[model samples]
Target: MTQTKKNQQPQPAAQPKPGSAFAYAPAPESRSVVDIAPSYGLFIDGEFSDAADGRVFKTVSPSSEEVLSEVAQAGEADVDRAVRAARKAFASWSALPGSERAKYLFRIARIVQERSRELAVLESLDNGKPIRETRDADLPLVAAHFFYYAGWADKLAHAGFGPAPRPLGVAGQVIPWNFPLLMLAWKIAPALATGNTVVLKPAETTPLSALFFADICRQAGLPKGVVNILPGYGDAGAALVAHEGVDKVAFTGSTAVGKQIARTVAGGSKKLTLELGGKGANIVFDDAPIDQAVEGIVNGIFFNQGQVCCAGSRLLVQESVADEVLDALKRRLSTLRVGDPLDKNTDIGAINSAEQLARITALAEAGEAEGAERWSPACELPSAGYWFAPTLFTGVTQAHRVAREEIFGPVLSVLTFRTPAEAVEKANNTPYGLSAGIWTEKGSRILSVANQLRAGVVWANTFNKFDPTSPFGGYKESGFGREGGRHGLEAYLDV
Candidate 1:
């Protein structure tokens, strides 16, 4: 989207009931409505209930800085209760045939399809992602995840994990704010399909979507206590991670936090899977199609406002084609429309929160201070929202903050390399090894680079594309374990 100055504030709006889904389509005039929610409660035992402590936290809309909802602040006690609920349910839930669990996931997937628009609006409002992506990419992939995993439910006998691989009881899942609903499905579908119960903690900033998911679970007639949703900040997540009752811990967030969680749950009886952060590289070779490469580059770093952990933040362009690619990128960037997330025409939406906005702004300044030339498209940011323009830094050195750090905004750092070895070196320079993109015409070059790349996922001539059948996650500091496809089921299985 466009860039806001950081101090802008939008007017307040009315709120909806907590755990209710918001439908913003089929309107007479406008295609969207700004929805707010009141008194969000934790989903425990398949029912919505307030936290025992009565503590709540405001979840603000990044698009307008408006308070969207006040969600339950689940503490250690709440986590324990939820885990107990899950544990109690696991006896029967896990004992049931895998086909039965598949049916539940199938019903949930259908409900997601039926309510996709409502879910998309709420997702956009809460996560500050463009509605186009929320509706098209995030929601569909969420449904697809369940659909893909549902078949595995009945066919687990032949899943190669052996016929008797049982579910790890009471999976404690903590998802990041970037792709809230999608990540929820990524973590939850496999856990449930494999006959495990889930106690999930959605990211603090994007709790609304997960709460909506809980509502979907209720609508789908899922068994009580099979899936619990507790919304709060890092403390709530920490509680879930360290709880003794939890059989496993699965988290998707920054590497810094992943390390802490890894250390906390170390040597414990709990199984853990972490899908952490990344500073991925998108390399453009001289032999690639200039126009297609431009689009790929734009999509690599700018999709979801670059909040993606797999965002191609580092651009390694062949020195010979650098100027041509940069020129096309500027023109391509100009066409991106950053505005109200609900607007069908809007391309870039708001940052997820004020704090994220500050983080992005601080890093942009650091790029400037480091002598990198910053270029932004001509676009008007929202007058009262957390917005940041798609920014690119030229003349970026490997040591530049924008090059090395995860800005988690629509900002890209451009660097040139003369050889494949140099490009590989720059691509692997980061501690995070989540994903990378290679755009070249030569198949041999693509294969060579893909093999040499340290990332878990490498897109050839494409970028940021995902599929339910494809396993995703990272290697090294980006965190361990995969999240989608058959490989993801391994994390929840007691092999």
Candidate 2:
């Protein structure tokens, strides 16, 4: 029974095993279904046109470093044209009966469903997320978001804000890259449902899907100049947000950028809403279900490779079950398959870009430098891609950069808490208030803890579950304003 006795018992030959060191067969999804054009132009005033200065930039696949297409870059002049178009269309668009606008949104949602497979494949190809995620999570949510907002279009009169809220004309929206098309849906759907016209700029790295969305707008027979798409870098976004023609500015990206946009729109008449970053905490109590809690932790941080704004990057586990939970987590991580994103079986895919990958690497290295015990499962990344192994940091302190900053990658920081009060305090310590999760068997404790977590969203037993009917936003520096449901209408309306 002792260590000496156990060491003397097992002696086996070193031989080839069945499942040890197994390699996944290459099962790449066909790109033939997706037809990437050689070049693309700005979608302004319901037509594709060149940049004012004819400047163009190339977009590449982060996974293979292959150039996907050349897209026209928009400058101040192009932004002006798009804004003018949206403004010109706003009068009629907003004046239309809510029923007509609702019908258009309903049509868009139906078309998105009909073309879900094509859109999913295109999103997976343009962004670095796995095909499974694009097909299952992102695309379905995109459609549902449109569908949910469509119903709200005709019902805004009875909403609590006021008897009759007026639409904010010519909304300027900027979206991030993590959930490209989904973010587009989130921004544009609410704006349109409120009868506002939009001039949106998709992230430069992931613009193809948004341009495809422009095609959807045309197919839906959305009025000319009602929706405009501009694909460009930050300068174009700056121009769009600062243009006097824009009455509302909606942005979803970094906290720094959000701050800058806030400053730019300060003292102006433009209304703004920002959905920014987070360092979400997944707290596991002593009396929690260990197995289910472990699964929640994994889904919390590892979904979308932890590129989520509300990812549970910080794990606050009770010291009693810390060892058990971490051991099980490490074992479960070892089974995760990471490789080509096109592979349906791949669990983790490429990083979104070289710059983001570098940021993640630097932050992770800082974690090790700050004396946290860094660990990653034994996994092989492809030679020709941007990939980071699923990582966990144990012995992490409150002051550690990884624990405090938004690493925004497939990295989890594990910290221990002695009591529920300490867990709530540690979770609330961060400036971000996007989301948090609590795992416990006690019903009263879930309510007690959820009430004090200082986050916009709280999940008692599960993690990362989203529904279109639920309004989502954050507090503090994580940014403000709701994105879904009845409350979302306030941002785009004169409530």
Candidate 3:
């Protein structure tokens, strides 16, 4: 482990009393459960095949910088092939009885549950997120999404879109590296439930889980060409989006790329939905419970190394309680563990890539340059692997880039507000409005403040919470269209 800079160093932990059992034993999750192949090919027409140009890329583990596998890099030709396959399968897949489709979805969900442990470990390895999070959060949500959409398979008529909702034929999906499997489930499950065939592209860094999912699809006896997984970079994603055979496009990525995708599909018959970037505000009120609010604040920004699209990167505290909240929040951050993604006890882990770590370091430096006071817990990062400390910036204003831009890191910008109106104003000051968190004990205040917030999803007294039955998206530059619940189905259906 390497020490951080002296000025930004975290305070050392107090020594445990001798012979006391207060210290935690290392409990690293074994990595043997996940078996990586030497090389992987694109899953097209229900079979693995080399890219047309025979190009490939290596996906490395962010935690150890180990090359996990070599995966096919899809090109324009590969994208066209996938779209053609999906187009060919659409008639048969959309013609299937809705209940029959439900059975296939249900089978996939059950298999996901049975292999949950394996998938969780693999995700932790490939994505560099803590095992605790993969085991507890991502995998369960993936399965739940499948099950939730399966239940709606035969019941789309009752979903209120129309008396009879129609499938959109083919869906082209692009998911980000963060929460790779969960994002894939979010895009794929609903499309299949609504009887649309899919050509999905996983982020280049985290393509393993999607390939694993293709195997699951085959195990469930899904028809050939119903689901195709293309592992590639932005060029392939562009090709997929521009393919004429695709009737719908769903993308979860950066706001910049989402805009490009929107333009590519614009003036065409393709339906489009984008779940993009965010700078969510977690507002702490004077009346909120201090300890609970601190935990919520920590979870909001620090979970997944703050790689989340809807992470609460901005913190707004009432002037009356700002001092108390800051003290408690800093103290809590000091105890968080920040190493070894496979460790069951790890609270923070590596950033997803060296490129991402560089971006985070640059932005955090910019925050300091802009005169925001920066602080981080006294945590040692590993000598190898990409890592960034959980950071906080005090004395931030809406004008500060740290408070305004999507840093997309474990860095929070603290701003103080005098009243509820001020808090709402500061929270809604950004162009992105994907989500927001409000901490208060009063129910009426929760309802009143929530109604005024411009974000797509607002939570009272909780942060970063998600459910399959709830709709989630954003207002403004965060991107349009929801991705869960009955609302999610609407994106894949023609009413």
lDDT values, one for every candidate: 0.88, 0.91, 0.93
Best-to-worst order by TM-score is 3, 2, 1
lDDT tens digits by residue: candidate 3, 78-184: 99999999999999999998999999999999999999998998899899999999999999999999999999999999999999889999899999999999999
Candidate 2 C-alpha lDDT tens digits along 117-147: 8888788778889999999999999999999
The TM-score of candidate 2 is 0.95
How does each model score on TM-score? Answer: 0.93, 0.95, 0.96
Backbone clash total for model 2 is: 0
Q: Which pairs clash in the backbone of model 1?
A: 1-348, 16-36
Greater-TM-score candidate between 1 and 3: 3
Candidate 3 lands at a TM-score of 0.96
Whichever of 1 and 3 has more lDDT, that candidate is: 3
Best by TM-score: 3
Clashes of each: 2, 0, 1
lDDT assessment of candidate 3: 0.93
For model 2 the local lDDT of residue 321 reads: 93
* lDDT, candidate 1, 292-376, per-residue tens: 8898888888889999999999999999999998999998898887878876666788898888899999999999998999999
lDDT of 3 at 253: 94
The predicted structure with the larger TM-score, 1 or 2, is: 2
